[model samples]
Target chain A: MSRLKYDDVETGATIPERTFPVRRLDLVRYAGASGDFNPIHWNERFAKSVGLPDVIAHGMFTMAEAGRLITDWTGDPGSVVDYSVRFSAPVVVPDDDQGAEITVGGKVKSKNDDGTVTVMLTARSAGAKVLAKASAVVRLA
Target chain B: MAINPDYLGREYPAPEVYEVTRGKIREFAEAIDDLNPVYLDRASAKAMGHPDVIAPPTFPVILGMAGSALAIADPDLGVDFSRVVHGDQGFHYSRPLYAGDVLSTVTRITGIKALGGNELLTLETVAEAADGEHVVTASMMLVVRGS
Candidate 1:
C-alpha cells in the first residue's frame, strides 16, 4: 500500500486517536503469544502473592498498542522505519467495566530532509500517560 | 528487596541462533494487529531491498529477553518478581531483521540504581547476525519495588 510521503506531512499534524480496551482475555492471549508467563500478567493468585494489586498487561503488549496507534494513523503500518519509547507505568487490566483503556494519539513532530517524519505519541490509561516519551521515525513511501 | 549495584556490567551468554521465519513473524504481527506486508511478504521485502520477509522492529525483543531474563529473574539478583514492573524499553537498529537470518544476542546489565523504595535494573541486548553484522540493540529497564 502506498503511504503518506514525509513531504506531505506537516508539523503539529495530529493522528486520529485510537483506543483499545485491554481485557483479561487479551492478557491470556498475550501470555501465550509472548511466553512471558509471569503470574502478574495472568494469574491473579500469583499476582496477589507477589503484591501486585491485580493482573497487569505486559510492557510489550502495551508498546504494541502504542505502535498500532502510530501505524494506524499513518495509514501504513510499514511506513514506520524506527520507533522507540519509555514505558512510564503499568497498565493494570481491571476485571471490571472500564477495563484497561489504552488511548493512543500522535503528532507529527518534524518532517526530516531525508524523507522521514518524526512522530511523537501519547498512550494514556487510567488518566495517566502509560507510554510516555514515545516517538517514531517513518519513511514516506 | 534489594538489587545489588555490583551486578552492573555483567554480560550474559549470547542466545542460540534464532532463525527468523515468516510464520513466527506473521503471528507476532497479527498479535500486534499490524498488517505491514513487508513483515511477511518476501516479494514485498525484496522489492524494498531486504533479502527476505523483514521482521518487525520490535520482534527482536522476544529473543533479546531470553538472554537477559537469566539475570533479571535471578532471585539472588535481589529482584523481587512480586514487586517488579517493566519501566521502559528502547531500540536502536543497524538494519532490519529479515527472515532466514540466523540471529543471536548478547545481553549485559548496563546499570543498577536504587530509586528510593525501588531498584531499577537496566539491560542492553545487542542482536547480531551469524556473520557478526549488528542488527539491533534493545534496551529494557525494569523497576523492582522494595517491600
Candidate 2:
C-alpha cells in the first residue's frame, strides 16, 4: 500500500482519532503472544499485591495499539521509521466486558526533507494520559 | 532491593537465533488488535515491496524482551523481577522486518539511576541480521521498584 504522500500532508493536519478496548482476555492473549508474562497485566490479585490499582495492560501493548494509529493513517505499517513513547500512566483493566478504553489521536508535526513526517501522538485512558511525548517518524510517498 | 548500578555498561551477547515467521507475526498483530493485511498476506506484502509479510514496527519488542533475559535475569543485577515495569520504549528501524529473516540481538546496560525509591535501568538492544547488518535498535527502560 502506498503511504500518505509528503506533498499532500500539511503541517498540523489532524489524523483521525481512534479508541481501543483493552480487556483482561486481551491482556492474556497479549501476554501469551508477546511473551511478557507480566502478572500485572493479567492477574488482579498479583497486581494488587504489587501495589497496582488493578490488573494493568502491558506498556508495550498500549504502545503497539497506539502505533497502529500511525500505521493506519499511512495505510502502511512499514512506513513508520522511528517510533517512541514514554509510559506515563498505567491502563488499569478491571475484570469486566467493557474493560478499559484507550483513545489515540495525532497531528502531523512537520514534513522533513527526507521524505518523512514527524507525527506527535496523544494517548489517554480513563481520562489520564498514558503515553508521554509519543511520536513517530513516518516515511511518506 | 535496587537494580545493580554496577552492571551499567555491561554488554550481553545475542541469545539464540530468532527467525521472523508469518505465524508469530500474525499472532502478535492480532494480540495488538491490528489486522493489517500486509502482516498476513504475502502477495499484499509484495505489493508493498516486501518479500513477504512484514511484522509491525513494534514487533521487535518480542526479541528485545528476550534479549533482556540476558541481563534482567542476572541475580546480581538486584532486579526484583516482580517489581519491574516498563518505563519507555523506542524503536529505530534500519529496515522493516519480514518473514524468513533471522535475527540476533546484543544488549547493553547503558544507564542506571534512581528515582523516588525506584531504580531505572536503560537497555539498548541492537538487532542485527546474519550478515552483521543492523535491523533495528530497541531502547527500553525498566523500572525496578525498591521495597
Interface RMSD of each: 2.4, 0.7
Clashing pairs in 1: none
Candidate 2's residue-wise lDDT over A1-141, tens digit each?
556778899999999899999999999999999898978898889999999999999999899989999998898898989999999999999999999999999999999989999999999999999999899999988
Which candidate number maximizes lDDT? 2
Indicate the docking level reached by candidate 1: acceptable
- Deviation (Å) of A13 in candidate 2: 0.8
Q: How good is the docking of model 2, by CAPRI class?
A: high
TM-score of chain B of each: 0.93, 0.95
Backbone Cα, N, C clashes tallied per candidate: 0, 0
TM-score of 2: 0.98
Residue-wise lDDT of candidate 1 within B79-134, one digit each (tens)? 77667778888777777777787888888999899888788888898888899998
